[model samples]
Target: MRIDKLHTIDSTNSYLKRISKEEDAQEDIVVWALEQTAGRGQMGTTWSAESGKNLTFSVFRKVKRITISEQFYALMAASLAVKDVLSKLLIKNVRVKWPNDILTDNDKICGILIESVIKRGKLDAMILGVGLNVNQTEWKDTPRATSIKSRTGIHFELEEILSMLLKQFHHYVDLLLKGQFETIKNDYEQHLFKKDKPATFIASDGTQFVGIIKGVSETGKLILLQEDEVVNEYDLKEIQLLY
Candidate 1:
């Protein structure tokens, strides 16, 4: 439960990989940065953080008896951790967008990137990188983007928020190991984007269809109800949710 705070790193996620070969880095060690120059997101996208205005940290945890199929459980835990911290901070309109984006009033406030490092035949460690827009007042002309300070007009201490997030993350991770996926799933569903409403979906072939948001499967596949008769399951990027 001890976090090794690394101040002013280029990127916490990158630093974890740089130090992964060292013998001294232990489990539960967290690498944090006040300013990240080369932060990364899922699929090689650059994660933007305005220096002191956001939360950028990576957590390294050891895992066992879990396959890739269970990776969504870890993501769900992290999403819930953000939700829990924000709720306590009195940020009321927050929700988790499926897979891994945290939103408030339908605007993105956080992004999570989880990477697993497997050595030989067993799981070595998993790196969870979280980027939370905390105190930024303006969002660089990006649509559907927001920050906690912009929404509430109150500034937050990054250190305190980081502490709360780590605690909640560990708690939910324990629930994940206990096979309590339903808890995470239900809570996540409650915050789903356009839940139970007709929405537009753009498939990979550029075909558009109108589907009602149903729910996600246990393995994290998105389920959609099309034409009130056809139900389809989609993996990420296979079907894009049109806002």
Candidate 2:
């Protein structure tokens, strides 16, 4: 794995996406920074991290073999990688929220964003950006977020955590590239947060409803069990989960 260390960047994802176009860019490379001025999160929101306090990085994964339709498995691979790492640290009650937000004790500890490049109807490389709240002692703007140090009272070395995560990432993504769908999906849901539980949600049109989560479609749609024997599938941004 190649590491491109930077003192600061606008966004690691953006940086990698730009650099991946270069003829010299290597696969399995990591772009890490001490701080991100324009770190991106899901839903077009900005991720804010204090300089030199947490892990803000993006990994480059060269996807192969699987059709464009099977892209969601790549997402599962990225999510499970982080979940497996946190669990090994003895983090209590670790759960992967739908898509891939990692939660410990029901508070968000990490977020994942996967950006892919496709050409001529074939999939290419993917930039997997991971933002983890590591040693930060406090989270002011995002009160619902927590850190490893905040939870366990012990600080961590970021490089060591990154190495361990990459090993697991290689394992799951290898299965994905081989088109092993069931194995990845089963493990992902088993560690999924709020699986089979009734929860509240808000629709994009400002409609509020209640439903039970029935895992996700192979395409990454959230399957909700509604009233009167109704089942509906929603893509990202169509629905928002309410805590």
Candidate 3:
């Protein structure tokens, strides 16, 4: 694993993509940035993190023999990797929110964004970007954001955590490559946030409803048991889970 340390960058994911195109990039190359000026999250939201305070990095991994339908396994691998790292640090209440936001208790501590490159209906490679709130202690405008130090009141070395993450990430990705779909899915659901709990959800059309989160479908859809004894699976664009 080669880590390219950067003082500042617009986005680590973008940089990795560029380097993978320009340079002869190899697999497992990590690009770590001290600051991200234009970081992004799911749903076109901005990922705001203080410079030199958080783990904002991306990893480029070359995939083989994986299809687009199997892409959700990559997400499961990444989420489980982060959860494993947090649990090893003794961070209690670590749960993986649907689609890939990591929450401890009620506040978000990490976010993952994975980009895949497909060719001829087959998966080529993926850029896995992670934004983890590590030592940052204060939350100014973001009320739901929290960090490891904020949760545990103890500072952590960013590189150490990154190393741990990479190890766990490789472990899960290897499992994915070996076609262990059921194992990964079951492990991910075990750490799923609010699983089997009744919660409110707002659809994309601004309609709110209550449903119990059963788990996720094989293709990464949120499987919700509705009030009228109907179970429906929704994509990311179809619904937003409300705490």
Query: Model 2 reaches what TM-score against the true structure?
Result: 0.96
Q: Which runs in model 1 stand beyond 4 Å of their true positions? A: none
Per-residue lDDT over 27-127 for candidate 3, one digit per residue giving the tens place of the 0 to 100 score: 67899999999998987888989999999999998886678888898999899999989989989999999998999999999999999876577888899
Q: What is the RMSD, in Å, between candidate 1 and the native fold over all Cα? A: 1.9
Q: Compare candidates 1 and 2 on lDDT and give the better one.
A: 2
Give the top-scoring candidate (lDDT).
Answer: 3
What's each prediction's TM-score? Answer: 0.92, 0.96, 0.97
**Model 2: clashing residue pairs?**
none
Q: Which pairs clash (backbone N, Cα, C closer than 3 Å) in model 3?
A: none
- Prediction 3 global C-alpha lDDT: 0.91
Q: List the lowest-lDDT window of 10 residues for candidate 2.
A: 19-28
Of the two candidates 1 and 2, the one with more favorable TM-score, higher being better, is 2
Question: Please, what is the whole-model Cα lDDT of each candidate in the order they appear?
Answer: 0.82, 0.87, 0.91
lDDT tens readout by residue for model 2, 1-243: 789989999999999988888754545789999999999998898898888888999988777576688888888888988988888887889888888699997799999998877867788777899999889877677878888888888889988888888899888877886778999988888888888989999999999999898888989999999999799999988998888
Candidate 2 lDDT for residue 175: 88
lDDT of 2: 0.87
Per-candidate total of colliding backbone pairs: 0, 0, 0
Query: For model 1, how does the per-residue alpha-carbon lDDT over 122-205 read when each residue is reduced to its tens digit?
Result: 666788999999998776756888887887899999998898998898798888778888898888888777879898889999
